[model samples]
Target: MPKVSRRAVLALSAAAPLTLPAIARAAGPADAKFEALAKGWVDANLRLNPVGATQVGDHRFDDQIDDMGPTGRAAIIKLATETLAALQATPRAELSRANQVDAAILENQVRSDLWTLQALQPYAWDPLTWNAVAGGALYNLTAREFAPLDVRLRSATARMQKLPALLAQARQELVPARVPKIHADTVVGQNKGLHSLVDGIVADGAKLAPADRARLEAAAKTCKAAIDEHQTWLETVLVPGAKGEFRLGAALYDAKLAFALNSPLSRAEIKARALAEMTSLRATMYDISARFLAGKPGAPPTPARPTDAQRQAAIEAALEYAYAQKPARDKLVEAAEATLVEATAFVRARNIVTVPKDPVKIGLVPEFQRGVAVAYCDAPGPLDKGQQTYYKISPIPDDWTAAQADSFLREYNSLGIQEVTVHEAMPGHYLQLAHANAYPSVLRAVLSSGPFVEGWACYAQDVMADEGYLDRDPLYLLVHLKLQLRVCANALLDQAVHVDNISRDEAMKLMTVQAFQQEREAAGKWVRAQLSQAQLPTYFVGWEEHKALRKQAEAKWSKSFTLKRYHDGILSFGSPPARFAGQLLFDLPIA
Candidate 1:
């Protein structure tokens, strides 16, 4: 069989790539058959989501926009159903270990796609679905330097010209009454940011080839017009009428959680574990705090066995030491960059892992992508030649009041930011994903598990704290535990809002009091939980699984177990779910 170039896949008919080949349906070698199905699925998905294809380094489909209209969606459903059936028919027992894991990933991805399109149709209700597509479409194309400026601008022009149709589909497909008001409200601001992206492309187009620049110039008008119209519909129409429930309830939350996590933990199991960990982490926080706060002025007594009030007061007092060390309002990026250097140096000194040398740059999160999370690690596509992964931090908006910024800074204080820097940059997402991208399996790279990615990042934070990254600073240790509490609280808040119908007051208390989060952080999280479902638990769930896997490895490997060896061993398998990675690492059964 010859290798199919990405361009060739798109050049062939856009709609035909999704159809299952005879080989996928009629298997010979199980691995070979699975590979064929996987190829078809990837090609089909790239065609179905052209903008996403660009993000993943397959720029062949960059000129095309996703066809999310009814017929287009039907084709996607057909592809998923066929690919799933073919996958189910394949003999998993006959496949190699790597193939078995890839097969599991493929099946889960296909099923999740089916569930999203079939049962949990966000297209009908979640305006963020369309907003994300509309926003990411241009940003992904323009943000990365995967190709030449002239070429990228030309593709950007093509996508820009087609914006109206996509927005029209959004307005047509979205049932106004079913849209969540929070989602609708959030997207209005996001949609407003589309014009900024357009202006960026247009500004960059000034350097394009004359003809290409002219096309981009024209498309900019079309794109901006469509965004304005879409903004109107979002603000005046959908938002006012959005009366839908934000909660997934038990049934839908359970289903989404399974797919989102790819873990064995149930919703109830996750809630129980998170709450328990919350208690444990707070106790540890108190223990760490007792070292700093014992006999301090106005501090609660830190007895060998303190009461809840004593523990809480002591922990609160210790956190103030960290809070007082926050960066100036404008210095977050500078501080994080310095922290990254310190962390990277610490990792090297400790020999904790085979730290990859791929460049990790820090920048501000794009305006359109703000309001969801504070920071993210955006790596280049596995196929892209560039190795620069952006560790983007969301800048404080100019409109924010002094009090809001103060609260935010206090929550993300200096030590807390160091913990986050460890999570998002050096020896965390950037370090781990550099290794993941280098792994030979493209299938695994493309469908990498969120749990594994997040788990590794969280585990990296724990590793640093354990290794005395900042020289056993009790203040840093306390901040790490409080942030850890937030991770656990996230799982609780995720389920609480979506399943338990927890009120705003209750949710705020959970974060601000129980989790020791500041008011600004708590308020932002309340909005985040509503906007995102089944996602918050990945940090906690993956953190626990990664930790457990390390324990098992330590006991199994005995004298052979080393932090660098174990870390490199697990990451070598690419970012599969922790269980699958553990099985591969331990040479256990793939099942």
Candidate 2:
């Protein structure tokens, strides 16, 4: 979450006058109180989580790092509990439709935060939480040019001075007996990269006056020494004793999934839907496979129901054709750049949803932020709407064996790269978020839902394929179906790992055989699934909601529907849950 500037918040408050609509103006007192509480919560959150504030372009807190010790955690818990109570006190029936929806979203957010603090309690076990805070405190200050070099450097130095305290607090807070081995290993790797903040960015890039430069250099040296010491402590002291369980089990998984999805569906229902979709999607892939292999020796007829082995063989053949077109390891960035241009032109020529003029840059993933997903769409904080958006792609690590690199490249081949470009840029995250930032509600923008964000990206892939993107090339369509298979597999893998205690062998078989994923990709996902839970399911769950919402709109509008209009209409509201967007679009009652 990002922080809004005081000027923007004031501007919104003055222009909109947060009150009930004409129909429910009699409930003005309740509406006004609820609005005040929402504003207060945002302000408090920013103040407490200063690194988050800086990421969202709020510089006031740039000089400080958050305190994650017991005292700090208690404050956060108190804030969420009290805010939730205040929201509940307001009568939902008296508010206007939009306000009612806002109240519900805020209520859910409060509960989610509380659950994270009280139940999940990552602070006691997850080292990555602390690692991110330390890295982001420096990364956010240096990565963007939102301020003058000297000013940002001064802030950076201040934050650097606090590194010892933050790291010391982490040493006190983390429970050695409860740390997971994988998480400890990941933090050990990540801590080594944190020095890049000083060596790469501050030392080389920060052009400071002689005196200030001397101070910054001293601070940088201190920070580097502290990090190196911490890394040693982590490897020698922490890793040896780490024995925490990664699985959340059935009860905790259910609670986390409900909050993460923010949908009305149960865990059982989501699993059932994903299983059905997986079977149907595999059937479609077989059809394409049969067509693709029609001329080959020993090929099954297009109309024949090929045996499972035959279907797998045909799909592998098609994948070989796709993999043959992969970019050289050195040329991956260049390929993504070229694909972005082609995808942008195709979307415009087809009159797909209007593309905003906001600029997006393609760059290598920063060293500190790697070890997660391969690529991400890093949009500007909603508060800073016009800043540059980054589509960060990770290169294969130089230390990897040749076999590992080859497997990674095979999965991210030319067609796979194009599909990623479409999802991250063009008609996907970049364009949708531009419209989201422009939405009139600052509150909604700040509290944007994950499902809506991830779902829109997945839905965009389907639209591109359906509209004959890349000239309807079967190879391109083949990759699209394969990507969908990966998405469906994600939901299954997420649940199976956390709730069912699925082993590595089982997960590998599911990915390699069922979804046709490469060994390197499956291995990375296995590590990620352990590091986090409930998030991987968002792509599948959100895509389902977006698909259902589109169908509902098409039925309601009948002869009047246009893809562009439907796309734009759904994005017009800030990135709320799909159910709320549906309510707004079809004039249905708000839940």
Candidate 3:
């Protein structure tokens, strides 16, 4: 992943080390000062958090697992507190414009970390936090070949050896009653993944030198036992005792959203924008639906002066055409592979943006990573030598009935998959992040802005539809508009579910009735909204910000503006927040 999923960005999670920022050219005294501090902090943080270091392509501390107790937290707190004080003391104007953007990213990220650890204290209440670190550390070591197999296996073994101690720390730290039921339940389902990672690494032990193989096997046995122990704890202790509220409530939600977006818009502003976008998109969807069903035998009449019910019925009827087109349940991976090629050809033919030649492939989403999201673009870390990115899709669980499968397939129908492909690959994440990694500074790359990365993908979807992808099929455009409507609902749902005490029934109605999402889609999203705070809004917020920036670019660049040029220019800077990227694009004040 270009940036670790927001839900997994905890201190011990398989997240990027909260490292320092990058330097800019022709730096001033303040720039030089910031550079020195950043360098010191990056080196120290990497030393402190080995799993993060490994994932980011640093190999120095591969054999270590992060210490998970008060002692480890103390070290990170000391580092961030000291660094943040120094950063705040340095006046923002003293740095170059480029440096100022990185500085802002650094400050915001560090503050978020502090808030998570010191105030929110999720480690005590969130079982998912423990599961992430336990699973992510081993997964990172084995997932890519940043080092040789034997070398990586040894690192994995070392981490495996520490699994029991880490679980023990979890048991000691976590308060059962404070653990949210969803979190406890989710972790119970995911704990076995730890065993899977351990077993996979140990299975490869035969390739290692005799003594090394011996150590690996020994570590695996112990790790497997620890995982089982943890699984038992999850089922018997955490799940039964779990009673904490799932919502973040207004105060905590607002604070995290600020740190998450770093955009100028506030919670109220995002909600208002979402409400307006929802109305406008529904109107557009209705128009497309009307065109699509104009000659249908028994279509709902979409009168020019239609009531709200008329518009709703027309759009719902039109969506049946999309829902009717489905890929076979067994052929999802094959169908997505085909759709990817088509998407790539379309982007190249239309010159949507500079399409990257970076190697990307379709793969099944790892079972452990399956529950939270349907798909993710798992790009190579900026530091990794292996350049392949996997566009992973979750497979239907075998336990699901045909009805459940049908609901899911309808939501991700043939055209919908193509739209998703456009968002995850082609000129979306794979391409955007390839450009992001090429930026000379790894500062922003170390801790990319969530909105910038997610925002670009959503914008890519808009670009495809605007440029008449799929032969300008109104049905396809209708599909895109349908998904776009969900984007708006996401922003609204993030606030409503957390801050406004919105009931589950209200959220379902908002998605299914208002947004027109499938029952399966709405249900999964409800769980996702509860699991992730401040992240659901990234899609809508990013799309809005990206659209605004494009308009600005069109006005400023005038005759010189082209999609290729605009895309390349904005992405030239590493993935900072979208507004910062725009500021850099126009050479405006970093403020």
Best by TM-score: 3
Candidate 1: pairs in clash: none
lDDT winner among the candidates?
Answer: 1
- Candidate 2's displacement at residue 399, Å, is 1.5
Task: Please list all clashing residue pairs in model 2, or write none if there are none.
Answer: none
Worst 10 residues of 1 by lDDT: 8-17
For residues 1-591, could you state the per-residue lDDT of candidate 1 as single tens digits?
000111111100011011111112323477777887888888888878886677777888888888777887798899989998998898898887878888999899889888888898888898877777777778878877777788888888888989889999999999989988899888888888888899999899889878888878988998898889988988889988999999999999999999989899988888888888988899888888888886788877889898888888888988998999999999999999999889988899989987765667788888887888888777777667653578889898899999999999999888888988899877888777767766666677778777788878888888998988788899998888888888899999999999999999999999988999999889989999999888788889899999999999999999989998898888777678999989988889988
User: Per-residue lDDT for 117-190 in model 3, tens only?
Assistant: 88888879987777777777788777766677998898888988987999989999999998888888788878
Q: What TM-score would every model get versus the actual structure?
A: 0.94, 0.94, 0.96
lDDT, candidate 2, 1-591, per-residue tens: 111221111110011111211223335877777777777888898788888777665678989999899888888889989998888688887777767877888888789888888888888898888888888888878766678788889898899989878888888888878999988988898888898876755664357888888888888889988998898889898899789988889989999998888898777787898888878887888778778777877664555777788778778777777888888888888999999999998888888787776667888877876787888876666565346677779889999998998999889999999999988887888777777766755567667777787888899999999999988888888889888888888889999999999999999988988898999999999998998888888888889999999999899999999898898889877678899999987888998
- Which model is ahead, 1 or 3, in terms of TM-score? 3
What is each predicted model's overall lDDT from 0 to 1? 0.82, 0.80, 0.81
Location of the lowest summed lDDT over 10 successive residues in candidate 2: 6-15
